[model samples]
Target: MRVDRKIKASYEHAIDNLDKKEENEQLSEDEFLERANLRSDLQDLLKMEEINWKQKSRVKELQEGQSNTKYFHRVANMRNWHNSLSCLAIDGQVVRDGNVIREHISKFYAELYKENVLLRPKLNGLLQYDSLDHSQRDLIEWDFDEEEVIKALRALDGDKSPGPDGFPMLVYKCFWHIFKVDAMAVI
Candidate 1:
């Protein structure tokens, strides 16, 4: 996008310079042809840029509308309503009280996650495999350098899901210099 903007600016500047030259002096056949060609090229570039801008604007509009539409909210509310537990059966009896339901859920999960196993089977000598040597272990444990971090970031697909902060790889890749220190520290 920046490159396109720069190209557009240069083309506009060239056209303006050509116009100024035409106004100042009488042009030869070749100069007139050059001016005409430049104008045509500038027009073509501007048309393409306008189409690109319109496409981007339409996409943004669609995304914004989808996110904020009444239908979207209704569907989300419907899903929440469906997922909510209004009643539960416990000990062959229906439970509707909120406190009872909460207690039942908490007790059920607590019992489910309770450590009941007193003795677990050991796998110490059952399986034998070669392990990594010192150098390999060191390589795996070493902190990432700037090059490695940049390479990993670059390797990620920019169009994939964004991180928890809602920024995509494209953002980091585009503004690496600004984010390098913070990103490295976090990593």
Candidate 2:
């Protein structure tokens, strides 16, 4: 609610002075028109943020299920996929441990999102999911050795610097546990 009010106030200020010509009377009509459109664009952005904030209540409900069982199921699926990929890499000759293959999937996700946004058009444009040729192709399918993978996970849980690039790796460890205990299937 506070954010919404703040956003509304900002919009009112922008609308009150859409035409800069009021202060600098020498300004042309074209510049004034462009500034007016910018205010509209920012208003739309604020509206979207407010809607997303409210929608979060539903998301939280879905995530906070009957118990932590749902969370475990989510984790298990991820470990299964990651473990399978590790095994594939070992068996396949085409793919090795490429430089970008982070134990934490978040890093790659950020890269993909950043690249996708950079390649796409400006606001109101459709998002394009493009393949990133920047990193070398990885034919690896992931079959991380069971024991080693488990041990590595335990180590990662206690890792000193699992942070992304620089920031602390808080959520990374949480996911690691989710993958190790909840995601991994029993033999």
Candidate 3:
């Protein structure tokens, strides 16, 4: 234990010396390279610290039966900086600006919607539907109760893509007691 402490102290002292050396304005080429290497090592240490905290917190979350896959995915995306589009092809030309990318996406989806409008079948039949039996009509138009909503929410996959509200079914399940009334109202 004493030897380990001494070694740690020596390492810290060496780090302090390197820091001082880095701040010297008259550093030689070799010293500059060494300082750059030390800076690189410091950056790596900071990255490792971030990763270590994430891993430890993940272990705690797993112990509590909470999945951290999404959290890890978010962290990985932040580290990789992949959310921004580097380039996109629009109108037979490559565009790299952010605003242009958004416009391209909007125009593309708008054109897709226009194309889909053409694909819709025209209902030419004029009131040619027969009335359903009492039970069949009741089944077709059954009202949803709180219990049914809860059951559907419970059956949903937590990892599935969220709806437009940006909330997964897992959130609904977790906060069901508080939001049940509002959810049933929406239904």
Candidate 4:
């Protein structure tokens, strides 16, 4: 990656100033040592900043290419192959037709989800729950404020799976101030 113009300019300016300081003959030993230490610290900070920038750039590149990468395609293809329904056994006979398999799956789910009184046990009065008070009801129905939103965002695990927008909670948490208004509007 190319060096940032501002960083490069600042680094060059610091080096130039250090060189000018070093050329001065009126400086004492303590002042000279202090200047040398300051120069070293500045160089270290600049190097660390460069490394930080590189890491951020690399992470951005990986995120942007995630859906298009060869590795992603390979993994997706493997998962599909593993989960594909190529054959089904019914009545001790193997069925290989795709349409038949689809129909069978559809019918299976339809029956599975179909409501059947015989399959469900009645739970009337089996469990009781306290009703919410007026204050509790009001709180539940209240609009989310910025502080609430920020608290919720902070409560999420940063390293968990990305949301629908393909960004992890860490991004939102880190940039809450910048995105607060937009996020609140969406909410």
Candidate 5:
């Protein structure tokens, strides 16, 4: 705590020193205003840096939570998380930002690991579908409304690649198999 207090005091002193240096310099009113704006910018940057540091600590905590498999839950309960990711549908504003996806997908992957007991060994490996190459992959396993992402992918001439689950539209195969339906309907 004392160290932290000292660091804070030093940072404040540095800011003060810079401000004093600007004040000491005799300049035009416009130049003085510009120096004041620089000081404001420095303050804002310091605030942003503090926020980034706090978020970094939170991210580590979330990672530990994921390691403990906290995100995984029964199907009925995990549906809400699935829906949250899937909500990145055509209408939502969530874009392809790495940090956003990192936060969301850590939970998603953790939940996925929990649900797929049959593939428990594969889940342990956790690297199957995550290796589609950087050019084609987002490096974050988000549930961007597959429908919309597919549309965008097509627009970009993306090849028909398999999803984290499987190829597009093939997701229904599970339903067909589970319900014991005929393939004729799909054909």
Candidate 6:
């Protein structure tokens, strides 16, 4: 209902000045064009947010399930997958201790990636496609809008693992209104 009201208001504003230019003309033609674009963009964003909310609700319902037993087993399986270690066999022995397993994995990967300083055949055109198309890439590199940043923060799963900073999505979402200006500036 709120979204419908907003859509209606925006539609009226856009249509009111559709063909006739404003007599006061405080805003330039470009500004008027931007206002017209805002109406459509707002409608599109509201629709997308509605759809995302519904999808999230459906996913939560499915995860909870009608039966508690099935939900518990499914969650346990996910936890196992997340915490599973790559069991490695080294020197005809099995190592399972946390530190030893980590060291073994590190050593294996280190040696696996070690470069050989030997003469090798030359390859031509290996760098093809290495450079991005500047024009095409520029399209995606625009600064984030405040609403876009907020939407991204809201979309992050609060239960998911935090990044290197150790701050979870819940923290960001909680303080979004306070930090939104600074966050948008950084973008």
The top-ranked prediction according to TM-score is 4
Decide which is better by lDDT, 4 or 6: 4
lDDT scores of the candidates, listed in order: 0.80, 0.56, 0.73, 0.76, 0.53, 0.69
Q: Least lDDT summed over 10 consecutive residues: which range in candidate 1?
A: 70-79
Give the alpha carbon lDDT tens digit for every residue of 1-187 in model 5.
0125465565566657666777787666775676577667656655665565445545765777644333333322443543564333223566566566666768778887677656556446666654577655664554445455435534542344666755554444334344233333332
For every model shown, the clashing-pair count is: 0, 14, 0, 0, 0, 0
Model 2 stretches astray by more than 4 angstroms: 1-21, 61-187
- On lDDT, the stronger of 2 and 6 is 6
Better of 1 and 5 by TM-score: 1
What lDDT score is found at residue 147 in candidate 4? 84
lDDT of 4 by residue, 3-23 (tens): 566766775676677568777
Per-residue error at 177 for model 6, in Å? Answer: 1.2
- Candidate 6, residue 100: how far the Cα is off, in Å: 28
Runs in model 3 lying further than 4 Å from the true structure: 1-131
For each candidate, C-alpha RMSD in Å? 26.8, 24.2, 19.0, 25.6, 25.2, 27.6
> What TM-score would every model get versus the actual structure?
0.35, 0.23, 0.31, 0.37, 0.23, 0.31
Which window of 10 residues has the lowest lDDT sum in candidate 4? 70-79
Task: Report residue 91 deviation for candidate 6 (angstroms).
Answer: 19
Residue pairs with clashing backbones, model 6: none
Candidates in descending lDDT order? 1, 4, 3, 6, 2, 5
